[model samples]
Target: MNRAVHAVRRHAVMAVGVLVLLYLFLPVAVVVAFSFNDAAGRFNFSWQGFTLDAWRHPCRVPGMCESVSTSLQVGAIATVAATILGTLLAFALARHQFRGRASTSLLVFLPMATPEVVMGASLLTLFVNVGVATGFATIVIAHILFTVSFVVVTVKARLAGFDSRLEEAAMDLYADEWQTFRRITLPLAAPGILSGALLAFALSFDDFIITNFNSGTTITFPMFVWGAAQRGVPPEVNVVGAAMFILALGCVGGAEVWRRVRAARR
Candidate 1:
């Protein structure tokens, strides 16, 4: 009787997991399916017919490509800046004790816990108070601010699990501080750093509410999609979404392959 109950529970758990995955990916599936849709009107929600025109002319809608370009640029810059700063901060928090350490840790969680609308509004007010114009720079700054917390948390988790004895062994083998870090520490931590940067880029790319609050004249891809939704979304928007999904998948796949290759070599 107990064996049968256990078997039933295992099946139930697997079913729940599958349902959760379907719920999460349903929207993404819809977007990818609509990318090839030929619409009778501006709205591409319903399938009229299948066509390759949307993929061929992804930038057919004016300003769509430009907005995508802006978003890419911002995401790239923000990821770089946030990764560098957050990695350093992670090292400090993980490896050393410092004054106000508790306070600093608490502050990091505040940004992550805060509502997006509140964060956006607060940033907008700060920029206004400082006479800073709301534009591309402001957007980048805002993204970096929020993204840094996530990076710090990720990198810190990696650091926490790292074996310090490896570094000590390197030192015993006549490796100096820089050599130990370069030859041993960094390679071990690279995965976490890479993950943090990818997370930051995705957050910056898909952000809508915060971007909307701070973007005075700048149009990001998300903002462009919002504007188009009022009139009618273009099929090109679906194409862009599909492209982003594919690009991210490719990157993740490439990373996994590289990791497997390195593991096999070792």
Candidate 2:
């Protein structure tokens, strides 16, 4: 009876997991299906018929490509800046015992815990008071600010499980500080760093609330999507969304395959 109960509980848990996944991905599946929609009206929500025109003319909508370009640039810059800063901060928090260490950690996580609207408003007010113009630079700054916390958290999780003995061994083998870090520490931390960077880029790329607050005249892809939604979303927007979903999936899949291959080789 106990074994049967245990088996039932396990099956129940698996069913719940599958249901949760379906709930999350159902919308994505709808979006992907609608990307090929040939709608007579501006709204692409209802599928009229399947056509390859949307994919062929992804930039058919005016300002669509431009917004995508702006988003890409901002995401790239913010990811690079946040990854570097967060990785260093994670290392410090993980390895060192300094004054106010607890306080510093709290501060690092505060941004992540803060509400997006509040953070956005605060940043907007600060920029206004500082006489800083709202544009691409402001958007990038805002993205970096929010994304840094995620990077720190992701990299810190990786660092938490890392073995410091490897670095110590490197040092014992006549490796200098820089050599030990470069050869031993960094290689182990590379997975975490890469994961953090990818996450930062995704956050920056998909962000709407913060970008809306900071971007005065600048339009990113999310902004463009919002504007289109107010009128009637273009099919091109769906195409872009579908393409982004596929690209992200491909990247994650490739990374998983690469990791398995490396493990097998080892």
Best by lDDT: 1
TM-score of 2: 0.95
lDDT at position 44, candidate 1: 78
Candidate 2 residue lDDT tens string, 29-108: 98888888888878776779989888999988899999999999999999999999999999999989999999999999
Q: What are the C-alpha RMSDs, in order, of all predicted structures?
A: 1.9, 2.0
Q: What's the lDDT for all of these models?
A: 0.94, 0.93
Q: What's the lDDT for residue 157 in model 2?
A: 94
For 115-193, candidate 1 gives per-residue lDDT tens digits of 9999999999999999999999999999999999999999999999999999999999999999999999999999899
* Poorest lDDT segment (10 consecutive residues) of candidate 2: 38-47
Stretches > 4 Å off in candidate 1: 1-9, 261-266
Error of 1 at 98 (Å): 1.2
Q: Kindly give the number of clashing pairs for every candidate.
A: 0, 0
Who wins the TM-score comparison? 2
